[model samples]
Target: MTSLLSAQESGIVLGSPLFAHINPRQLPQLLTQMQASRRRYNQGDWILNEGDPCQAFGLILSGTVQVLRDDFMGYRSIINNLESGDLFAESYSLAPGRRLTVSAMAAAGETGILFLQQDFFTDREQISRGGQDSAQVRANLTAILATKNLFLNRKLSYLSQRSTRQKLIAYLSDQARACGSRRFEIPFNRQELADFLCVERSALSHELARMQQAGLLQTRRSYFELAEQLPETDSPI
Candidate 1:
């Protein structure tokens, strides 16, 4: 991990949810207080591995972070993809003494992240982190954690779908909604998309082809456009 954050890097850190209401001038002192550092990784690099003791809360500073689960035979499943400004590992970090159940990996080039070493909300932790008490930062951290938890429940809903088409529709619809447009680019390619949906790669490809032919959606690589009237019937859980 790098000890210093460049001017541009400092802007990214200050703009993050965890630093909400914090002044730019106070960042260096705050980073020092929390024992946090910035780091960047190349594509496919491991940011956090499963079963490892979790001590820090990680925030994606740039590029993408793919949270993955592995099976006994080493097959991998994509739990979720987090983009720049997204937070990860907060749950474990807050609880303390818990090991990670999934791994976080770089999805593409130069994935940068910030790791803050203690529970942001705990009074003792706040005192230990230099007695710089800021209620705004604590409120911001609580809101961010709650938002992440809601998204996790949404992911669980997608994973429970019985069909590849159902899973694809559910996930894509949410992506479109998130972007506020019918057209949007997703973080995953075909294989990674299959892993995210917990479906076979071949099945996912075939289903996409069928959906395109049926005029339900049009996709090229990672970009997609959903028909105004989606074919999804079941309400999202």
Candidate 2:
């Protein structure tokens, strides 16, 4: 069963970008106004389903959330995998009549999410009454949405690659850049990586095995080492 947002978890939310410039002392009132509630989900539990009304903006307080989409044939693809401190559903929350196109599921044990209703941001009367806090949240929300757009572009860069090797190269190279090293551990497993890359698991595995044999890269599970040239992708086009 889910419980109330604890003091420590509230601190995490207050520290997030969406809550930037918000005063800690006044956050309780803002939470009350926004009708914020905390919920917990076990691994594999669906937190939000596709076609559902997207009325709340969610913040991950703990664990991982996998944003996924499924086709009519029930094939699932991972749109994004978010971890602690990441925000979700902000765009949907801001859209008056939007429904979610993707479902969010817990990808780790006991993921905790704090959901704040959309009315607090949309209510003109509330915004007028809210003073600086409301204005700051509005600014923060804009920043969050803008950041999400950049993230979308980054994901597109990976997906737009012509081949599985190219896609993996784009993604792993970026990951290495982010970690400031050619060696790092990725968050996704083989299957999750395949889903995120929109490729068949067998194909992904086969490609990785080929790359390994060719000495382009080395991998033991999720850990990888690019031996030279940021060219873990030199194995492919």
Candidate 3:
């Protein structure tokens, strides 16, 4: 079977895990009644442009995409980096017709996405038929939103700190935990990491060199692995 068919046969339903925030029962109705398509994007392709109308809710099946915005002064700031199992194009769920404030682009690898039309989620009866208590539903949604808010806050905090060392340390620590592995690969390359962190590439490189010298981490091409004895504060859980 193809990957898509295998996924379906495995009973891997939509809106699970990352989207477990939504009621599971509602998910079947949400998916079956709505349209979904698997689309591919080559590396460096734009999935969405800034100011585009948010028309659908997207889920990342594989690969990485960076969310960024170009300022009036023509400087680009990366808001976030999304990887497999992440959700995107979520604005339509909150506010239809709202323009995407940031642009999304496939990063190093090809990306696969499944998107649902926004209007499909607006059916109150369908949403409510899941039989979850109002409080339970609100709590689930809150947890989902809270996870996103926390991630944003962490990114902001990292950017606010002085020195590339601090930012790099924070980023690596965050990634280690997110990947749930002591030895894990970063989702982006050095250049992409520098861009996402809003730092000069040369400066970031120097800091990374210093980090390697300090025996905190090791880099092999685009992948980084945390040395067994990273500084106490730098070690990921």
Candidate 4:
């Protein structure tokens, strides 16, 4: 909705698109008076770990951060990627005593975030009085959660297939469906996609090339164009 964060900007503006739809106007004066800070995390820097106390919530003002969880065997799986303008730790912000269930880290370059504390949301009376605004905020939250659930369902479908090629194809097919077209742009690069898909970068590239050669898809950088059908013998997974 807003231009990606600028390299020259040191911090996020309160009125930025990152918070545009969050309905701060419904917050009380005390909450609206909350302070803000900019934090920088280097590549691979851990922002938070699972089971850690949720001290503050943040928004990604710049760069990319990956939300992931590690299994008992120490294998990590990415849950999602937060880009500029995306909110992070929202559930933590709302639920003070809750523990973080996943870890976050800067995927590349330095990540910049806008942090706010629980004190910023202290005035429940104001929120209650701002009836329509509060309703809008609740509606927005519900819609976002619904979208997230849909995304999770799609991810599950993508991962259920056994074939690596089928997995990639399934992901592309879902993306196409989400965009309501055969041609669509992917939000992640090869490395990020590999992480999202739990595959090696080179392996993803090879598979993508193979898919294109097989007439199942076409790509120019992050933009992919999918065919309505795969090769006759490939068989849908």
Best by TM-score: 2
How high is the CA lDDT of each candidate model?
A: 0.82, 0.86, 0.68, 0.69
Worst 10 residues of 2 by lDDT: 228-237
TM-score of each: 0.90, 0.92, 0.74, 0.70
Could you tell which candidate, 2 or 4, scores higher by lDDT?
2
lDDT (Cα) of model 2: 0.86
Question: For all candidates, what are the clash counts?
Answer: 0, 0, 0, 0
Q: Name the regions of candidate 3 deviating beyond 4 angstroms.
A: 1-15, 18-28, 123-142, 177-182, 225-237
Each prediction's RMSD over C-alphas, in Å, is 2.6, 3.1, 4.6, 5.3
The Cα error of candidate 2 at residue 136, in Å, is: 1.6
What is the lDDT for 202 in model 2? Answer: 93
* Per-residue alpha-carbon lDDT of candidate 2 for residues 1-237, written as tens digits (9 for 90 to 100): 113567778778888887898777778777888898888999999999999999897899999999999999877799888988898887888898989999999999999999989988898898888879878988898888888788788888788788998888888888888999989999899999999898999999999889888887899889999767745343222
Number of the predicted model whose lDDT against the real structure is largest: 2
Candidate 1 lDDT trough over 10 residues, lowest sum: 127-136
